[model samples]
Target: MSDTLHPLRVSNDALDDGAELRARMADDGYVFIRRLFDPDAVLDLRREMLQVMQAGGWLAAGTDPMDGIADVSRQCTEGDPEYPQVYHEVYKLQAFHEAGHWPQILDVMGKIIDAPVLPHPQKIARLWFPKFTRHTTPVHQDFVHFQGSFDTYTCWAPVGDCPVELGGLAVAPGTHNVGAVVDHRFSLGAGQLQADAQDVPWLTTDYEPGDALLFHSLTLHKALPNLTEDRLRVSLDNRYQAADAPIAEHMLAPHLTQDAPGAITWDDVYADWTDDRLQYYWTERGGPVVPRDTSYSDRGFADALARAKRGDADARLHLERALRRDPDSDRGRQAAAALQADEAPSR
Candidate 1:
């Protein structure tokens, strides 16, 4: 007996601007589909992905082969950000934003989730979780670094059917309105992370590929473990917005570095952002930063940023670790000084 309304499909049981589905999302805090992809599209996407893995030999969190059609494009990798698996060569592909690599994959996600978000911190990434390992994403909201309101829903669309034993996503229902954060210093990896089990009831989502499971930023979610036999799970997680909701990039700023080296112009990416339609959306959110330095290390920064956005106090420690790793960075130095000052009183 669910109390919330789900965002059900309009004409074909396929989810649209339906009231029930929206209600489900608003009340329950997540809307998951057991399966949603056409076999053909899933097959094609997998084939293309394989080509990318074969070509790049490695990939970072937001990189994919489709984005690397160009001779000198960006590619994702599992090695340290500073010294990737292949240290000498710069593999971060510039083509991710090019709109060619896995056109079908992105397009389908857009149609389903209604919000085709950029997967990369910079844009939608074709991340390759390290072999024999899975990413340990903790429970938190996606609104901070992600552009737009916290109401945004994520559609984790894996390429294959994702069963619980195969590294599915775990989420706490009816927790979307749980402020921007709570306490979680003791929480690590999976489990409640200092939260009351009764306060937030989590659902283990066992979904299939060609389909997606949606969750709000405040849903208190984490990536499930992948201990399946031989087969690995892959997915294309997209975010959706109500038709009236503005595009994500419009809300989050350009998500860019000041450097113009491999920068892709917004003018070409999409048309509307230039006229300050974007400026209006970010009235309080602020605009893209003219990164004083691009040498910022991401190792622990992603976790720290996610934690800070969720209002976790201890996230500062990871932030400090990240800054220590990025000695020659403006973002780092400022962070270092702030971290030292914050800890000064206790010492």
Candidate 2:
């Protein structure tokens, strides 16, 4: 699926030039910087994350955890029941959360935003398994998921060297210039939604450790499928915005905490943390918080219900996940109803 890929324009040359960085971000909707972070630091964090996975039996026996040799039998994603069991353990890593606030990233984001920047509290990590191409992240604007301001930026960086076969992110340059959210439909991908981004030229590269791809919230982007035989593709998906810009209320919590089966809480995440400095540090910072718009997800669910009625297997799986995640929630109840309707005998 990554057959047609162009090299991203390297923006490290303008690292110190705020005017040039802002100019390029305005023109291309993204800034690709090679080795944006210290390679050793990235590797250190990768070791920490993968070790947690290894402990959870997600990695192959006798293999070094640092190699990220995934046990494909344990291939489950965010929506799957098994994912949270291990993911919540990884979430407790202090280093993992600290990586989101790395000074270099903050510095560049401030320059691009032309204001003091706030690294979003709900930091995310994509721990993708190989041979799981069907669950690869789909094309869509970040606004559909992170909703706050169109000025919000997602800074994605791999935890280790990520070749094309390992599946990193790619962007359709200047797509954010559309200046508005486009139509999205149900998807079995990470976000459970996909935007149609056909016929557009895609830009990506064989990303090395510390390389970062920063893009606007409304930019069209997706992950290239991981086609490797055994390795897991791990990456950071942290968001940032002007310190005074509005933020969605959900962005204040730990990422995907509500979506996790038992619903992970900040207290659970901080119980073992040795440092408390970053804990709730954003409470006094950031701009006014606003409620999240549910329209995007509401439409996606509607699409899934229709598709499931027509016997779409992926749609059925998505709904099944919703039901299993929280049967008492409103969406979970709707999923149950739709599934029951689909299973009813034809009259």
Candidate 3:
């Protein structure tokens, strides 16, 4: 792929009609809205998150919270037992919950999904530390992970200013039409398809607070690695779908289970909340639950894996093809493991 980055065409909220916005999403598999929420609100959440990080000894002692300066010496390597503990704390903040349900965000989601929408209760917060290449999210589609309605949309917003170098998201335009790709496991706890990104034009921009990207569930997207050695990148991933649509059972669960070490119970997270309305909102409605499509063979992934195991010269290519065809299947995971071993250096 070219080193040059292409700016995603921004949709002006005032100028774009619902039809126009929907058209943009259908064409690009995502719509980038500039200043969709209050910038100050976003920064406030950033400060709140940083305070939590500071308490966890993840931030530099003297730096301003808004700066998000990481304590390099104190950084915990990936898979460290304490790492998930810190993430669990970040997930429990009131600010985090409030931001996920911000009114403006829901309004936009309503327009896009064209129905009553319920934002998934389990929100994801990404904290990207500088120079941590393994921490960068790999290129993957969200549909496999979230097997709810195919119409589900993910709204990603930076909690603070995210320059391109700060590792904002980059998406391959119109990749949703390609359907689910076979995905291999990567660092950063997400699956990555091994297909060359050069096959599609990638779009990204310097994201300011309030700017948000709403993408289709199957869109191919990835995070740009944080290049700055001192700064931290913080962002939110919140999903929304039509209320009548069947949803995966896991989407309603808390982000960190109570069983996980250092996880706070949902009861404790809601204890001080003044608004009782937000609690158990989805369950009270009794929405339909749907089983996620976890089968990968319908896309011929099994055949591809069989060919690869036969010592085919194009084994890697076959695996990539399998992933592109049915990323949600069990075969996709097997294909990923085979590809990982293929890439590993010999002893």
Candidate 4:
């Protein structure tokens, strides 16, 4: 890995003009908006997240929730069978759901896409534990995983201050133009694509609360490893596309499905939420649900698994489709296990 860090071109001006904003996104693949959200509000959400972890005994005893000190001895590795169950609970937090529709974030999305924005109901909360390299997200594009709209934008915001050493996001500039790259197996998560840094440099920054990184679904990005000794790196990923565009049915579902016994449910997440306005907002709006493009079907399990064994980048997607197509079959179960071994978290 190169020690050189390239800073993302910051856009501080309000993006009132749709043409200019769209041009920047098309050209750079991402636009870093500084202080788009209230930092204090972001901190409150962070505290809430840490509280959930603390209550679950995931955090170190006698430490403040904000401190995010992990009890490593009790911490679950990415490979643990119960890791997904634990992650499911964290993903269902009400704070994360609320953050998905933050007015400021939606405003930017609306302007850039030049349409009424429809934020995806399924939000992703990345809780990267310090010193746990096994769960770090690999360099990959969101398009393959979220096959709804080619114009979909993902907004990544850290819940608290995140310096480079603490594992912020790094985007391989101009990779969106190259489209999806072949994926191979990687030690952490499912797999990652090796970037040609000489052609498309990796750009990143010391992200702070309220700072958001907005990028296209095809933009290739990865999380830097959490090198800190004790603190945890918590971040949120919310996606948006034009309201008129066709959306994948799966995107409308909850972030984590109740497939397993201990899985989190929508009711559990919304139990304390007094404001019901956000509940099923998209469904009520009557957005169009289109058939999901399953292009990965072309790469069958045998070929994918064979490639996976040799660390092919597309292995995860192929396995995922298998499970989606036949979750109850013997092959489906095997696919599920393979995904688990790869530590593929729910997007």
Estimated TM-score for each candidate: 0.55, 0.97, 0.80, 0.82
Q: Model 2, 1-347: lDDT tens per residue? A: 34689999999999999999999999999999999899999999999999999999999999998899999999999888779889889999999999999999998999999988888989899999999998999999999999989999999999999998899999999999999999999999999999998899999999999999999999999999999999999999999998889999899887776566567888888999998999988889838999988889899999999898878899999999999888998889988888888888981
Candidate of highest lDDT = 2
Clashing pairs in 4: 183-312, 183-313, 183-314, 184-311, 184-312, 184-313, 185-311
Clashes of each: 39, 0, 6, 7
Write the residue-wise lDDT of candidate 4 on 1-347 in tens digits.
35677888888764676777788898989989988999999999989888888877778899999987887765453334445556766766667788999999988898888888999987887777788765567677777667787889999999999999888899987778976644523233432323223455789998999999999988888888888898778888899998888788767766544234345566776777778888778876556797755454233345555555444555665556557655886657877777675555541
Model 2 scores a C-alpha lDDT of 0.92
Identify the superior model by lDDT, candidate 1 or candidate 3. 3
Full-model lDDT for every candidate: 0.45, 0.92, 0.75, 0.74
lDDT for 155 (candidate 4): 96
Candidate 3 C-alpha lDDT tens digits along 74-168: 65432334565677777768778888899988888888888888899778888777777654676777876677777889999999999998989
Off by over 4 Å in 4: 77-80, 179-187, 190-199, 258-262, 291-304, 307-347
Query: Candidate 1: lDDT of 16?
Result: 45
Candidate achieving higher TM-score, 1 or 3: 3
